[model samples]
Target: MSSTTETVVIGAGAAGLMAGIWAARAGQKVVVLESTAQAGKKILISGGGRCNLLPSVADISDFYSGSSDNAIKRLFRTWPLEQVQMFFEYEVDVPLQLEGETGKLFPQAQKSIVVRDALQNELLNLGGEIRFNHKVTDVKKVGGDFVLACGDNVISAKKLIMATGGKSVPNTGSDGFGYEIARRLGHSNLPNYPALVPLATNESLLTDLRGISLRVEWRAEKNGKTLELGNNDLLFTHHGFSGPAILDASHWIVRDKADLIINFTQVSSEEWRQRFIDEPAKTAHAVLSDIVPARLAKALLEKANVKHDDRVGNLPAEKRKAFIDVICNYKLAISGNRGLAVAEVTGGGIPLDEVNLSTLESKKTSGLYLCGEILDVIGRIGGYNFYWAFVSARLAGESTK
Candidate 1:
């Protein structure tokens, strides 16, 4: 006979594991099920295995939501980043450290295993049952109880929590089946896209510039407006462009389908024009090589149809203007970004309106809670996603009264 528990949490990733630990420690009969034999596969690989736990400062503005209004702002108010960090430090008993000025926080031990083991141990010591290799294939609500089918056995629970994450890396077990399960339970979905993923451009053009890394700003220009994505090192690959600038800016560029302009130097066009006018004897490439990678500097001069050895004063007015335009505003057309298979986190999922942010419970169905990447809120590159997973799960588990 299948017995019923107070809460049945599916997927042993960050959210599910955290929820079970929280619920069990609160004296509830909680059971967490994982399709994979091991839990926290993504966690094991995150932050190069050290696991970037959270950001030193996290805010509602750090995320992009598929919702109409900025409901994510309200969600953070319910469970802020500071409270979540304190939960890990004091309750989970994990020491933490801040990563320089980036505001990224990581486990002091510098191993993702520390995070995985801490949550697992806390859940087990508090009398929670976690079943591995138990894939929840189906769910049905019978009366006030929820019945979940896993292979030959069926488990019933008064409350159900789905934390199966979104499709990012398939090998880590996020296959996007979680979204299908939500749809089966009557939740609508938004289009999912690969965010925080390296972008691919014309290989022929970038062949000579592979492996070159430089710090620069990437601007997504669309219909006369320029959108500035923050500065970071831009890596030129044989296939396309990458590094911090490309990945962080990929979201906006992908959405706008805009042309990307790489600003090799921070100086404005007017400033560079005056500087070039002041230096009549300096060659175009000679001045550019000082600010940008030598190869890139040469390429920009060659692309502008100006000779590398040509003096700035000898160049024609139209030619100089064109050179200034191309150098100051080096552009590229975004082909496409890597798919969810290599993406860090999926952009869209079940709409935010489908669930109550305060409890992370589904509004369409009673006793059904959804947390983590299952929702529409996707965070920036850093530790924001994991922060959401832990907080939403912790709150969902606590609300299973």
Candidate 2:
């Protein structure tokens, strides 16, 4: 069906929905076009279905990891953490509870659908109409309005906002389509890569260690220099490694050809070895299984060909040092990432300089705005990405009026 509105929002994901709601509330006719059968597909699967809303301590600098530091700083100053929290709290009654070390925030009930449905309901309450299965094939400016051709219908709006997200999770409809649209509108896009995704290891030993998760520290190293270190939950998948710790480390790994070193002991090899040597009778032969999980300890020892039954007194200094070295710095060569289909977010999008930090509007194209993962701003695992989407969309909506 042909339709017209003051503002047409592309992609009914987090950013698009928020934009539609804000614009509609401002008395501007707004319509949201979603390519998928349902809205907020990514939000449904985020945080394992808990919907991480925003971090507890929303430090703007900590959230963004890009070259456009000035732009990111300016954007956050306009819509800081406190403002973001108020936006969600007023829209939805869901109370946010801060999770683990990373200030990640989740609903008190830990249900993602609650967050998604709440936002969708708010949009409806604001008189924002949503069109599902309305895949925009092309967008062009005709006269003074934006024309979006989708299937057999043509949608026209005075302003266009692209919140189509990035290449991450193609099944959820973020297939890098928005990048092409932005490029066509004279915006330079950074090379997009999968971020917050699992890493594939070249080590075949990972096969036997599948399903083993431990609280440990992982560091990415390039040219024998430590690049990044993340200490949290680390999972040993059949292919390689995953979980929060590994996912955070993947960002640094992408920048260089790095070797990931897992420190199961969470202490320096020298210190651990010295402790073991000083208390041989009490700790050395105490079975590594006693300190760590039995399965993990056994697997590590087996991989190193160190006999588990060997007593401390019977073991030589060299063997003890080798065992300590392996536990402290277990090296795994990262072959590559899991790709866009499996990534939680894309690392790059339209360059930040191409858009105004204050309004999130296109500098080259008047009345055109961009938000969410569609922009080059991407955050680490947590609610940072969601915050970026909400803040940028809010600013765009408020500025357009």
Candidate 3:
């Protein structure tokens, strides 16, 4: 059946559902279209199914974007974090608690379905409707309204919000279809790659280190300049490295082909050398184990060609210096990444400049708006991406008023 509405939001994930709810609250007839048989499939699996709903705190600097930083800053300022939190607490009635160490906010219910149901119910309560199993195959803008073609019926809207997300985690229904729609509707999209993904390398040492996890400082560098640096837990996988630190820096590796380096001890070369001098009688393995994991320490010693029982002071000068360097500045040649299938988010899409920062309305297409991962902004893991989805869609929905 062909139907027309004042606003039609494509893709009923976080952004689309949000846009529909707000638009309906604004007294506009709103319909949200979803390709999947269900809504918020990605939400169901995020944060290991607990659904990190929002960050306890968010700053503009926490997000990466190729467009003007000032523009992104303005968009964030439009919807403050406290206001969004209150909306969940009061409107959706989902009490949130903070994960102290990570600063992530989760529903007190501790289930992602709680958050999804809150959104779906809120939209329905506001008289908004969601059409599941309605995949938008094509979109066209004629004269004053946007026309969307689904399989057997057409949907027409005076205004359109595209929130189909990015190419990451395709099984959840975000398959980069929104980018194709954006391009067809007169917008130029940037090259997109998987972000927040694990890095893989064939380094033989990693095989022995699998299942080991430790805190590390990882740095990504390109062209002799550092691109991104983060300190978090790193996990040794059978393939390579997977953890908060490596996933956070994967963007630079995939985008600019940056070199990956890690500081296992978070200690400077001089500091390590001083430790060796201070403990002359100790075996190198014993001294290293104080800071590094035992398995990793043994592996590093092996890689440096230093005997595990070698006394720190008795070692030759070259051998002593070599081990110190390895501890402080170990570099890995990243063969590849786990790709979009397992990636937490995507790196690139329609640049922010293509839309009005105030409303996320397409600058080229008069009535089209964009939000969510389909945009160029790639927030670091934690709840920052969800924050962007909620805030940006709120702005787009309220703009309809």
Top candidate, metric lDDT = 3
State each candidate's clash count: 0, 0, 0
| Local lDDT at 231 for model 3 | 86
Evaluated against the true structure, the overall lDDT of model 3 is 0.89
Total backbone clashes of candidate 3, pairs 3 or more residues apart or in separate chains: 0
> Residue by residue across 1-401, what tens digits does model 1's lDDT show?
13888899999999999888777766689999899999899999998899998988986656787775457776677678888888889988888999896778999999999999989988888888899989888898899999889999899998899999999998888888888888888998888888778888764656578988988866877787876556777888866888768877777776667778877777778987888789989998887888988888877887889998999988899998998888767787567887788888887888988888778889988999988888887777789889888878888888886
lDDT of each: 0.84, 0.81, 0.89
In model 3, what are the clashing residue pairs, if there are any? none
Tell me how far the alpha carbon of residue 232 in candidate 3 is from the true structure, in angstroms, after superposition: 0.4
Evaluate model 1: give its lDDT.
Answer: 0.84
Instruction: Give me the displacement of residue 366 in model 1, in angstroms.
Output: 0.7
User: Model 2 over residues 299-371: C-alpha lDDT tens digits?
Assistant: 7786666787766555687887777877888886678888888988888778887887778889989989998
Residue 321 local lDDT, model 2: 72
Most accurate candidate by TM-score: 3
Tens-digit per-residue lDDT, 1-401, candidate 3: 23668999999999988888888888788899999999999888988999999999887768998988888889999889999999999989999999999899999999999999999999999988899999999999987988899999988999899999999999899999889999999988889999999989888887679999999887898887988788898899988988888888888889989988888998888887888789899998998898988999999999889999999999999998888877777887589999999999998899988998888899989888898889999888889999999998898888886
Against the true structure, candidate 2 reaches a TM-score of: 0.92
Q: Model 2: residues >4 Å from true position, as ranges?
A: 1-4, 100-103, 282-287, 310-318
